[model samples]
Target: MDLVRHLECFVAVAEESHFGRAAARLGMAQPPLSQRIQRLERELGVRLFERTSRQVTITEAGTLLLAEAREVLARSESFLAAARRIRDGETGLLRAALTPDVSGETVAALLADFRRRHPGLELELRELSTAEQLAAFAAHELDVGLIHHPCDVTGLELGPVLHRDLGVLLPRGAVAAGLDEVPLAALTGYDLVLFPRDSAPAVYDDLLTACARGGYTPAAVRHGRGTSFVRGLVLSSGAVALGPRDTHLLAGPGDTDPDLVWRPLAGAAPAWRHSAAWPKGRGDAAVGAFTDAATHALRTTAGARFEPSARPLHLRPASEYWL
Candidate 1:
């Protein structure tokens, strides 16, 4: 028996108080409507109505069940509505990550834009490296991440790739810092302050390779991730750090240091590439929204730009690409 349909018939007859009127309201023949009500009464083992030639009157039992039937219908409608919202990615928990090197301004931009776009979604953002984000994706722990390029992406989907040209941060007292632009080969005696190799090995190795090609190799590679840490190493140890043209990246807030300068690399300086990534077959609307926000933040806040011919530059060993 179609229980809901039977209950609907019962309710209609109870409210209409006449078989002819109930059938007309339900857009069904009077005989079929009466049969449905009869079946409902049999199923429940209770008579729901008293019918005479003059009028129809609902039973006390029928009156008691009317409110329950209406409540069930209302609840069913609410369930379907919630399901639609989930399917459309309007409400849920979304786990996202950004690399440590990302500027503070870019992080704020990404958060503000993503929230504006998906106010119903709860964003759980974290600071993670490309390596950590990839591991999280493999373990099903992360939904989306802004990751540095040249890392393995064997089972991931990527968003638009953006690039930021890098410059050097050196002590202002250094001879090379006096020039309009520092050549890669100019700082022969300075050690390099770089992020730890384990954080992003592929990018780490690629950066060293680019340095070698440009005719400069650091006396020693000092690993650090925090801005203050890198700045301390650069200032105290005479080490130089490769960074974007943004001086605040290394100088930190309220830093009016007279001994620090950031200058563009004169030749073919390396460009850092980034893109939003998620597990394969999981590029849903929420992930797409995050990717759009990340791309916008990188472009507008971090001064990164999309390259028309963007591709992973250091995926393989350098020897593999040699002519």
Candidate 2:
């Protein structure tokens, strides 16, 4: 007989003081209940109850075991409750990674909304490049990732988050200042500060291809590991950088240098795309919750007719290509 099962029978019988009543309370036949109690007594070498024709009274051993049995059942109930909460995404840690190019306002708003929805959950945020985020997801070190488009995505599932037109960041009083929009060809004479190609190869390549189409090549290229660092370099060195038109959302009043200005790129600038990624087979509730929160936040912030793409970047039409 299972020890806990027997103990349950014993406790029932001891409390009810009648075989028929105990069996009814346990939703079992009296014979089975009696047998369970007999087995339990035999295993312990002690009679848990003293029985007469009309009455059943628990002995000292029964009283002692009753307390412990109740405690065990209580703890078991607590363990099950905790497990259910974690499975429902009500309690636990959610580890999320993002590329450095992701806007700070975007991430902050996402986390704030997720926290409101799941107060018991803790969030772990890491700022990594798109490639690094993918590596972390592959190793199961990250629960979810916000990454640039045209990623490897071999064993991952992606959901499009946001898309914006490309723009150029230039120092004040630069050669392109008078124009409302800067043509790609007009950037030929300026030193370009760009994120390293290894950090986001497809985005970098698309930028180069677009420039080539415009019949211009950068006079010099300087690499930076992150958006903020590259922007800083552009401010200090009078270099130009290309970024999403909404890049200003990531900046505070004092975040951008007073002399720097962001202007839309004239004619056929490729759109910048970002997506949420996770392991293909991952079924964790926290991952799903975070993804939902991120999608909603992006839509709310974009405030336009934003639509998530149903296909991967590579499969999308040429017009929708992300740079």
Q: RMSD in angstroms, all models?
A: 3.5, 3.8
TM-score of each: 0.84, 0.84
After superposing all C-alphas onto the true structure, candidate 2 shows an RMSD in angstroms of: 3.8
Model 1 C-alpha lDDT per residue in residues 211-315, reported as the tens digit of each score: 888888888999999888888998999799998864265444322667688888987888788899998888888899999999998899778989658465446
Scored by lDDT, model 2 comes in at 0.75
Model 2 per-residue lDDT tens digits across residues 1-323: 68667777887887889999999999999998888888888998988899899899999988888898788767777888989998777888888986776566777888898888788889998888887887787778988887777767788887655676777888767888557988888877778777787787776777776777875577777898566687778877757888765456235342255577777888877566777888887747777777777777666664322434544566232331233
Best by lDDT: 1
Candidate 1: list runs displaced more than 4 Å: 1-56, 252-256, 318-323
Q: Determine the backbone clash count of candidate 1.
A: 0
